[model samples]
Target: MARLFGTDGVRGEANTAITAELALDLAVAAAHVLGEAGEFAGHRPVAVVGTDGRASGEFLSAAVVAGLASAGVDVLDAGVLPTPAVAFLTADLGADLGVVLSASHNPMPDNGIKFFARGGHKLPDDVEDAIEARMREPWTRPTGAGVGRVRRLEDGGERYVTHLLDVLPHRLDGLHVVVDAANGASSVVSPEAFRRAGARVEVIGASPDGLNINDGVGSTHLEPLRDAVLAHGADLGIAHDGDADRCLAVDHRGEVVDGDQILSVLALALRERGDLRGDTVVATVMSNLGMLRAMDEQGVTVRQTGVGDRYVLEDMLAGGYALGGEQSGHVILLDHATTGDGVLTGLMLAARVAQTGRPLAELAGVMTRLPQVLVNVRGVDKDAVETHERVQADLAAAVDELGSEGRVLLRKSGTEPIVRVMVEAVDQERAQAVADRLADSVRTHLSLTG
Candidate 1:
């Protein structure tokens, strides 16, 4: 059988691959695994659970609560909140564990379950594997007296908003901001948080009907936000995914400002205030070369990690760095959050605009993004990309042709039978041509049937 956990969590089509049974089993197993680790040895274990605004999340959250309670763990239901909010509340409330039911940027049909250990930290691989292993073990049902209780956390959202407000360096009093909440977890809180921070806010993608989450909205689709920004003549716009753990922005000109530019802007802001720890920022391998060059010019060091926010977090923690994030806008400001907080990120970005009296376009201009092209070649043996002689030779030749002005990266998809071919250069035409040529080579050299 395949492993239940992916890079993020146990995620799949809700009610099918990730059914109620699976959610319950995972929760019971997690309680056992964490309990045995002495996380709940002295006192009764408390679990904080939250979910995005998905219809399926209602059932999943119920299943998780049942499982945790049956295993003698009290459940604090923080309903319809962002994943990061659950993480923060888990730590803030002194809960022993945290559970968030969300599929992030995935469509409405899909859902996931992510667990956080004490202190709001992502579970290590060993802990997750152990939870999986324990799922197959026999259950020890607790009696009525030993069973756990359930409660509601009514002020969880307010607490999170208060935290963001307190951490913000400047209020967005004079800014005109547009917010696209993707009709997901942040729909209610994101707009409210920004408005409370003093920005004149207009919102779209804020009306969710459960099934409409991430449909033609959010960070993945920038057109709606861009048009809204221009139509409203707003200073800028912010978009969040289904779970609101990350954010992407649009300038007043309606130009998209992606994660790379967001990172550059925040890094500079933190550095200016002497708050950038170790003068270093952690980023993923997928970050544009331009971001690194920009950091270098500003006397800031860029620490590159594998393509995941967790990897960036690991590097940041190891070096005591204060800021790190993925190119997809999942930024972690360790000073304020243990995980990425979309509301916090948007507030800080707008605060920068407010403080400097500079438009977001000018702030984002701190890094000039290089033209990038990515091709996904499917129906292939992705693992062979590194060792195949013909593919290696072709890739080497392409790298040589681009010289120091460009680069190529061929990586296997972790969860699919595909290989990603990415090329970046000074010109879009060259990047696309080089990427397509390498993709063709991958298909020819690594096809499974071949």
Candidate 2:
């Protein structure tokens, strides 16, 4: 059978691939698989359940809560919180597991269920496979008082915010900051956390009414945030994705700073403070060449991984690295979070600005981002693109043209019929022209005839 779970979790359009029944069954199965050890002495293993602001999440959350409780697990219903909050509560509240109902940065009509183990860490592949296997078995219905109970886990999110404030290396006093919440999970917690740390705060995309998540806002769309920062004469801006697992920022002049830059800045900061583990930051291959150059100048090492933050985190943990993230804004500070955390990343970035008394734009001068362009080539046998001599030649020529001043990347999408063609150079026009040339080569060499 085909797998329901993806690299991150089981995600799809609401009420379709991710139905309520599936959520229920998966929740019950997880309770059984993760709670089999007489967890909490058979006291009904506690589970933390939360969701983003998606309207579909309302029913999904209830369905998940019901399944776990029916399977004899107590439910800490942490309603409308970020994915990290669920993980944090799962560990802090001593729950057996955590389930977050979100699709991360995906559109509102899309949703998903991502799980965290007792310590707030992502489940290993073996465990996820086990849960998938168990999902096909007969459902267990605990009878009598053995059935679990459900209760709202209020005030728990505040604790997470407090933790974010407590861990800051310096306060953000006198710095005016703008926060774009993406009208998703971090709407409440992120703004409150930033304000508490003493920053003069302005908020955009905070008024989520479910359907508005990731709609022309958040990390994926930075115009509103940039405008807000400029309008308020703010020191900078931070934008959280749908589930607040990641953030990208804008400096005072409304220039965007992605996760690569954030990691670059943070790695240097931590290294100076003697906290950076091995003086390294783990990032995906998608990171810009400018980041690499910046780190190289600082004597910091850049470790490359595949696209996902999970892969980056795996390498970080394996190598005892403290900082890792992706170009798409998922920044994970292993010292503070078990998962990617927009709030934590934002606070830390703000703290750096405060500590140095330098504007975010000045600090961002640590890296000069090369203009890069990504073009999607579709309707081809993507697997053959790399080995085809014509395509390889195109890539080689583009690389040669780029020389030391640029880079090129051709990546096949994991779940789509598309190959992403990316080129970066000293200028945007050169990057776009090179990318267009490569994309044309891919089409000519690999285009499908229907």
Candidate 3:
């Protein structure tokens, strides 16, 4: 059988692949695994739980709570909070584990379950595997007094907002900012954080009715945020995904600022304050060539990993680096957060804008994004993408042709029989042409049906 966990966590369509029974089983198993690992040696195991306010989350959260409590783990139910908030609460409250019921930026009908360890850190692969293995194993049931208790954590959002404010380097005294919450998890706390930080705040995609999240707003959809920023004449706009673990921005000129640009801006800001540890930042292999070039020119080093925030985080931790993130806006400021916190990222970005007296566009201007084109070629033997002779020759030719002014990357999809061909160049036309040629080569040489 395929592994239950993907790059982030176990996710699927609600009530189908991710059902209430599965959530319960996973929770119980996680508690058991952690308990056996001596995490609960001297005290009863405790867990912090939260959700993204999806209608399915109502039932899913209940199932998780039930599982944990029945397994003798006390539960602090933090209702309707972002994924990072749950992580923070887990550490703040001294809980042994944290569970977030969310599908992040997925469509409303999809949902997911992810866990955090004692310090609000994501579980390592070995631990996740152990939990999965223990899910169906027979175990003793806790009796009356031994059963864990559940309590509602009514101040979770407030506590999280306070933490964000404390981590902010500068106050947004005169900035007028617009926030797009994706109508998901950060609907309330995101705006409240900006307002308290002294920014004149306007909001859109904040009225989540459980079904409207990521419908036409949030980071995935920038049209609404751009229009709102232009209409309100805001200094900048911040967009958060469903569970608010990622953040992407829009400048006052109504131009969308991507994660690469955001990272460049933050890298400079942190460097200025000497807070960028070792003057190094971590990024994924898929990061734009522009970001890499900008960092090199600025005397900052960027370490590239595979295509996942977890890999980026792993690299950062190993090197004691202070900044890391993906192109998808999952920025991790290691000094303050154990996981990516969208609200914290927005506040830090705004603080930079306010402190330097430079517009977001000007700060983001440090890097000029090269035109990038990506082509997905399916019905191919994805595993042979690297070894196939003809495909390798075509890729090498494309790379040699692009030379110093551009780059090419061919990656096999982790979950599907597809190969992604990405090319970057000085011009869009050139990038697209190279990417198309490479993709055609992949299809012709590696076709499974052929």
Candidate 4:
């Protein structure tokens, strides 16, 4: 699992684990894997390539484009765009595969590469495994005219914006909105889309120096957006991370609205508009218990998955559901996108406000979120923590103590040797106390002392 890809893609500090040479090798490998699988039809399979606004992306993109083009796959180079835009273009342009050079919300020095299969869907787990396995075997490269060619496409952004506007239900006239681009990929296009949708838009963190992305701004930290919204007396504010695949909102009053709130509001809105397929929402286990209560009241059933967006997307596709998301702002509105889409999510959320003529804060009030506290306990046998008897007993005892008001979860870190003890309760202190007790229990029983 740690070989070529991470939770998102092949990520590493620039020029370290990730390099021009490595990027080229990966692109060539991907072409063989995607092409050999019959991804291309009659014509040579084409690929859409794009990247976020990281300084490291310039070389990475060039390397990736060179690798793909030299491998007999035509390249549609859509430079400096959101990840979802690449996904949309792949599906919209009828390409065979799309490659996005981004580490998502990772830091400035860190970068990665991710791929979308035909129809703009993330590669399946088995496909990912196959690619990793193929990395070790000898690879073939085409020669001369048999090799693929790369072409620059200028209308990539315009075409994506047009598609977004076409899907919108209403214009955003009379709406004054502040957008925080996190100095990442959405710096240009996000503001453009909002303006075209008719919102009077003010931009913050839109000027990316390539090194400042997600620095004191973006969805990971929402204070900047909150201030901009209140300072400008804007109708609302939206924040996007490095890759611009997820969004978090700040209301007119400078109050922050998270993914759970957004999902609740959008679910009801979609239900009213007859667009919420199957009257269901797919969410990860990390979703607030408050969301469950809200859905229960609205008679909307929720199917829960693990924490990753890929897991949520997989569940949505399997269930044929139209909506899914994580608590961290990753959302998948499958009717409009096959993956988590910040632009699409922001568009739909803003459109709800526009069409309803209500404050986004009020519309987001469909649920009262319970206070959740997560304590990560390091220096423990994380894998054993889940099966340890004392830890299990502590979890069961905590649940029995809180009953309907609260519950406890002990989740092992996938990449690190740590245990995350989470507790949700009616109040903050209680949740923190329960989480502390669980962490202590895990340390006592699974501290690797043996």
Candidate 5:
């Protein structure tokens, strides 16, 4: 059978690729696997479940709750919370498992199920595979009182916000910030958290009718946030995705500050305060060469990992690094979270601005982002990109042409049959031209239909 879980989780179109039945079955299987694996041997297994503001999440969360409860695992339903909030609550409440119903930055018609093990860490691949294999297996069903119970977690959001505030290195006093919650999970809590942290907060994209989440707002689409920040004359803008696990920002001048700049600023701030662990930052290969150069010049080391936040987290845990993230803004401050927390990233950025009395653009000046272009060629044999003679030759030529001044990367999509061609240079035109050539090469040599 095909794997249900992708790099992130079991994400797909709601009521189609992902359905209530699948959610229920996954929950039951997760409970059984976690129980048999000794997570619940001494006590009744407990799970903390949450979802984004997608309409599908309503039924999906209910299905997950029913499945876990039927399997004798008590459920704490944290409704309409961010993914990281669910993770945090799971660990804070000492639950055996955590589940979040969200497709993250995906549009409203899609949804997903993400599982976290004890300690609120994302489950390893082996554990996820075990859960999948256990599905449809026969097992004795619990009856009456032996079945688990479910309850609403009334203080879940408050607890999460409190945790965020408690971990801040500096407060956001005197800062006027705009927050775009993507009309999803972070709508209520994000604004409240900022206000509590002392920022004069203006909110946009906070209204959710369920179907409109991520429509034209959020981190993925920064135009709304940039315009909002400019119109409101705010010091900065923070944009979170559907589930708020990651964030990207816009400066006062309406320039989008991406993950590379964010990571660089935080790393420098931590280093200055003598809090940087090992003076190292872990990042994915997608991180810009300029960020790496900045870290190098600052006498800090950069550890590169694969594309996913999980891969970045694994490296951080292995090396005891204090910071890591992707270019897409999934940042993990190891001291604060086991996974990425968009709100936390935003707070740290804003606090840094307030502390230095520097504009966000100045703080982000810690790294100069290289002109980068990415071209995605779909309907291709992604596997062939690695070995196709023409594609490899084209990539090598691009690299040779750019030499030390630029970089080129061709990566295969883990979940889809697509090849991503990326090029970075000192000039935007060169980057785009190189990316187009590589993409054309990939299309020619690796066309799936051919």
Candidate 6:
């Protein structure tokens, strides 16, 4: 069977691939695995649990709570909070584990379960594997007083907001900001955070009836945020995913400011304050080449990782780097958060605008985003993308043709029989042309049907 966990966690359409039974089983396995690893040694174990406002999450959260409690782990049920809030509460309350019931930016029918270990850190692959292995294994059940207890953590959101405020470098007093919460978990806390930080906040996509998340809003959809920012004549806008673990923004002119630009701005700000460790920021291989160039010119180094933010976080933790994120706006400020916090990222971006007396557009202008085109070619032998002679030959020719002025990357999809052909150039036309040529080559050479 395939691994249950994806790059983030176990995710699927609710009630089907990710059912209440699976959530319960995974929670029990996780508790057992952690306990066996001595995470709960010398004391009773505790877990912090939260959920995005998904209807399916209502039952899944209950199942998870039941599983953990049955395993003799105390549960602090933080109802309807962002994933980052759960992580923060896990650490703040000295819990041994944290569980977040969310599928992040996925459509409303999809949901997932992700866990955090002690100190609010994402579990390493080995630990996740161990938990998966232990699932469905027969084990003795706790009874009587040995069964754990569950308590409602009514102040989770307030605690998280206070933490965000305390770490803010500067207040957003004079800024007019628009916040789009994706009608998900951040609906309340995101706007509240910006307001308390002193920005005049206007909100859209904040009304969650549990079925509207990621429905034409959030980071994946930028049109709503752009329209709102322009309509409000705001200094800028912030957009968060379903669980609010990722943040993307819009500038005053309704131009989308992506993660690369956000990272460049924050990198400079942190460098000036001597907070950028080793003067390096961690980014994925998918980051725009323009960002790399800008960092190089500014005397800051960028360490590249695989496509996932987890890989970026791994590199940051290993090198002790203070900043890292993906192009999707999953910015991780190591000094302040163990994982990506959309609310924190947005507040910090606004703070930079407030402090520098520069518009977000001006600050983001530190880098010029090269036009990038990606073509996903399916019905191919994705595993042979690298070894196939014709594909490699075509890729080489494209690279040689672009030389120092461009880049080409061919990556196979992890979950599907598709190969992604990505090309970046100084101009959109050239980028698209190169990408198309490579994708055609991949389809012709690696076609399984052929």
Candidate 6 is scored at a TM of: 0.96
User: Quick one: RMSD of model 5?
Assistant: 1.3
TM-scores for all predictions: 0.97, 0.93, 0.95, 0.94, 0.97, 0.96
* Model 5 per-residue lDDT tens digits across residues 280-305: 99998999999999999999999999
Which candidate has the highest lDDT of all?
A: 6
Model 1 ranges off by over 4 Å: 387-389, 415-418, 448-450
- lDDT tens per residue, model 3, 1-450: 667887788888999999999999999999999999999999988899999989999999999999999999999999999999999999999999999999898899999999999999999989999999999789999999899999999999999999999989999999999999999999999999999999999999999998998999999999999999999999999999999999999999999898889999999999999999999999988889999999999999999998777788889999999999988899999999998888999999999999999999999999999999989899988889999888999999999999999999999855345798989999999999999999999989988889
Question: Whole-model Cα lDDT per candidate?
Answer: 0.91, 0.89, 0.93, 0.88, 0.93, 0.94
The TM-score that candidate 1 achieves is: 0.97
* Full ranking by TM-score: 5, 1, 6, 3, 4, 2
Tens-digit per-residue lDDT, 110-178, candidate 4: 888898998999888778777777663576667888888888979998988898899998889999999
Whose lDDT is higher: candidate 3's or candidate 4's? Answer: 3
TM-score, cand. 3 vs. native: 0.95
lDDT of 6 by residue, 35-61 (tens): 999999999999999999999999999
The clash count for each model shown is: 0, 0, 0, 1, 0, 0
**Consecutive 10-residue window with the lowest summed lDDT within model 1:** 409-418
227-262: candidate 1 lDDT, tens digit per residue: 999999999999999999999999999999988899
How do the candidates rank by lDDT, highest first? Answer: 6, 3, 5, 1, 2, 4
Error of 4 at 369 (Å): 0.4
Worst 10 residues of 4 by lDDT: 1-10
Residue 136: error of model 6 in Å? 0.6
